[model samples]
Target: MGADYLKEMFGLEGQTAVVVGGAGVLGGALCRGLVQAGAKVIVADLMEEPCRKQVDELTQLGGQAAYVVVDVTSRESIESLLADSLKQSERIEILVNCAGVNAGNDFLDATDQDWDRIMAINLRAVFQACQVFGRHMIQAGGGKIVNIGSVTSHLPLSRVWAYSASKAAVLNLTRNVAQEFAEKGIRVNAICPGFFPAEQNRKVLTQERIDNIMHGTPMKRFGEPEELIGALLLLVSPIAGQFITGTHINVDGGFTAAWF
Candidate 1:
């Protein structure tokens, strides 16, 4: 009975999750977690190769997963992703917006191109995906959305002005969308992650920057990709998280809590 209760609270059995940017480090971890919970996962990304690679990794780990190539910058591409997801699983119960990009440059050196690109992928893409998937979820009754924000979403850091701004907007957008869909049974939330080393921010982690991050984070260590799985599951679970929406979880190891 206890096992059944736990499963009833968190089991994603027979559900379908579409994770945009599921080819990347953090996204891949979420996909694996969804699979472990008995959900069929669709790994969506810009590149066919990386998407396929992520799917293979998930399958090898005994998870059911598939790949769908997408260009988040394009509305049509995101629409295609939604259609393809429906084709694969007949329905999408969970959606995770995790695709993002970043670059480090002196405030005076930042260019319009850099800002535009980051905003397009980090903020604009998320907006579009939510709208497209949200309409479907609303009509189908309900769904869950987890948008990837960052520690910068709460507080700004040096050297990544555009990224910080975009992430801050993401949290705001998450709240607005969540409020709009609350009565519609669609729960929208954001996950603000701390400094984790990933391909997108690898170049931005200069030695000096790394030192500052360690000092700011109470944990004094980077978060492992898998460490975010629990929070993701909590936000995605239909019963356990039924009443949760419009808020965000900061998985930054007390980074936001530290003043020094």
Candidate 2:
């Protein structure tokens, strides 16, 4: 809001950050935003093409960035990501866990494999990333962690039972990590976003789904990927968020506040 607020409170210059799932739309937006604020970013994704694309975009825009292929479902992949990250900057002072997915199956149609996959990617991935990179943060003396949740986790959404359940778990995971690591100087929190078209929801968000979302959202529009930058910066910047932890800031443009 003011120069002092930014100059004194929201500085992230020169910090090294790791953003899991940085290949997707929202994740790409976050990587660029962090770069603008002067944080060195590692764009970690499951695939190389999209991840490299993000790195190219950031480098073109004069930002410090790199790519790491990570399988959120595997412990070995997480370890490699952290290892490669250290090779680049030797520290992951800030991490944003965005490696999540939704199979979009109804509870009745959901199978065991579907359940396991969602849990591993959406919930356990965050747990693994935090535990691995979090150890680095702890050794270095402090850090920031932002886990991504979704509005559907709490909203009465249909045909995505496992996704909702996993996201809900993230809410508690954020708090628990915070409480356990606060004294050690790691701040963990989650961001529960409202409906926005992404890789997972594209198929379901047809014309009919658009009508439903716009009608339901108080803002009456889908959120742009850029809309999340400010809140992200606030949470990741220890200067601003040193006293904030075990909490979530909803950036849904009033999607949760309205029941009408």
**TM-score per candidate, in order?**
0.98, 0.96
Judge candidate 2 at residue 108 and give its lDDT: 81
Clashes of each: 0, 0
- Local error of candidate 2 at 221, Å? 0.2
Q: What is candidate 2's lDDT per residue for 124-157, written digit by digit as tens?
A: 9899988998899999999999999888656657
* TM-score top scorer: 1
Q: On residues 1-260, what C-alpha lDDT tens digit does candidate 1 reach at each position?
A: 69899799999998999999999999999999999988999999999999999999999989899989999999999999999888898889999999999999998988889889999999999999999999999989999999999998988788888999999999999999999999999999999999888987789998988899899899999999999999999999969988999999999899998954
Model 1 poorest 10 in a row by lDDT = 251-260
Candidate 1, position 237, lDDT: 96
Q: Which candidate achieves the best lDDT against the true structure?
A: 1
Local distance difference test values of all predictions, in order: 0.94, 0.87
Candidate 2: residue 243 lDDT (0-100): 93
